[model samples]
Target chain A: MRYEEFKEGIRDGIPICLGYISVSVAFGMTAVLSGIPVWAAVLISLTNVTSAGQFAGINLLVAQGTYLELALTTLIINIRYFLMSLSVSQKVEENMGMGKRLATAFGITDEIFAVSMQRKKRLSAPYMAGLILTPVLGWTGGTLIGATATSLMPPILSASLGIALYGMFIAIIIPPARIHRSVLYAVLLAVAASCCFYYLPGLKKLSGGWSIIIITVAVSALMAWKFPVSPEDEEDE
Target chain B: MEQIRIGYLLGGIAVMAAVTYIIRMLPMAIFRKKIDNVFIQSFLYYVPYTVLGAMTFPAIFYSTQSVPPAAAGCAAAVVLAYRGKGLLIVAVGAAAAVFAVQLLMNIIIV
Candidate 1:
């Protein structure tokens, strides 16, 4: 076990935790505004670390969306994690046991996946724990602060901080898109696809959760076909 | 019972957590062997970028009090991040940009 890897993983996760805390703070405010109790709001963040899925789930709960609707909506929104987990699994050392693997899987958010993928070695249990620890706490911790301090938090500050999570994501993707043509293509195609879903009335009627699923899968497949990664790029796995 | 009720809320969160965990768990547990397929590997590689792209668009534009302020924040993130700033700096800068624009807009509108 490389204590070095674990330390490095913690360092890498700090930014993610910062990003997560701010957004989950926004979510915390949202839950409070929606009449969700503070404890329940924190519970949601603790159990489900996903940004979109929790937002959608809370919206559904607020609007009285059926259980089937809740389940199906989250299922679609979280499908991206499956792809991430698969890619991450290829990197994880095979000697890892099932119980440890499950714990690691619980923590596989988009930021974690991105940071983990950049590692040029087999992902280890300790490294993943290091990666997972801060973000998980940041997410739940932010929610706690947000939920408990709604009256104290200025509306404008909470509102502004809401976009920080997406900012982190933009920061993550834009660098690669700027440097790589295929990545740029994938990014553009995804935007176009998302716009269509948003603007077209027939499609506009579809939920945001559904739009993400269709656009992500289709654009990823097209980019994969159009620009298959070279051997050198796949070296870490 | 309505979803807003405590019982429903608990049930809903449990179900959502279960679904999310299963989605994340099954792939790692099932795909034990090294996957050699080029197409699949590429597809997985592109998944993160594409997903982030789709989620960011249109939504980020509407995430704040109004579109212009949100746009300013996103632009700040893009510009700062393009210049290779740290993630904390980029995110904080974006939020500060949005807050500043929002403050200015309130001054103008009032």
Candidate 2:
């Protein structure tokens, strides 16, 4: 890649990196508090790069969750990425090869996609590559710091750091929820499902992983099928 | 035995990386042809929002041992977000509300 391209990628990736750092620190702290070894926590963050799935998976692992349970749960939570990937495919150059496409897929997180989609032109491979690599490093780096320093940081500070993850989630969800009526419905449905899962009998005992997957897919699919985004609205982007 | 455990952990990481790569890579690889299907395209657009809502809403209220605080916080955040507050403001506001509510709950319960 040319130096200019590399520089551009770094420029585009900085905000994403900052966001990842805050979110990953919370993940690391939660993992440590749950009694997982710090290194294990770091490894999970590095590999998963997913906030909800990793959090749910860790809870299951702590409870001695089965492999099937873990897989199903993570799948449910991450089902959204499948859609995100499909949307991103539209932005990729028409002639882009499979290898580059696959590489780009690894970096297709919510923030990265938001930034990428906003671009006026087709996305470049090097720029996407840079976007993916920087955030991965930031997340892993944040996890490492949080895990290694769990004991060193005071309790209040760790508690505050935990808030960072919630902050990041709010950042992601609120923007779209405000602008789109359908998104608002999806959020409400998810909140209601969570309440039902927490309060209702039998469902209360359902694994966290499964709960996330089920609630997400069922509600999302129902909404998509029933009230599709109109074609006229599509041109708003 | 310790060495074997380490091997297993590394093995897990490797496996996860490969699976993740494949999941992200397949569409880019297999569907080199344009996806002209309107239904499929629409499904792709709306699905991410649903997934995000699913992942996030639950966390707002449920964790090891609290509910009211998170619920209130989420409510506050939702209102603020709807009002067109920037992301940082909405998040900080929600988390702060949660923290404050939790403190109140602790006082009342005690």
Per-prediction TM-score: 0.90, 0.74
List candidate 1 segments past 4 Å from native. Answer: A62-66, B1-9
What value of lDDT does candidate 1 attain over all alpha carbons? 0.86
lDDT of 1 by residue, B1-110 (tens): 23357898899889999999999999889988877889888888888888888888978899899999999999999999899886778888999999999999999999
Native A-B interface contacts kept, per candidate: 0.81, 0.35
At residue A115, what lDDT does model 1 achieve? 74
Colliding residue pairs in candidate 2: A73-A209, A76-A213
lDDT of 2 at A207: 62
CAPRI tier of model 2? acceptable
Error of 1 at B70 (Å): 1.4
What's the C-alpha lDDT at position A153 in model 1?
A: 63
How far does residue A150 in candidate 1 sit from its true spot (Å)? Answer: 2.3
Residue B40: error of model 2 in Å? 2.3
Clashing pairs in 1: none
| Candidate 1 residue-wise lDDT, A1-237, digit = tens | 489878877887898898787788878988988878888999999999998899888888888889999999899778878878988888899888988899999999988987787677789998998899989999999999888887556889878987887788888888778888888999999989998999998999887777787887899888889899966776723
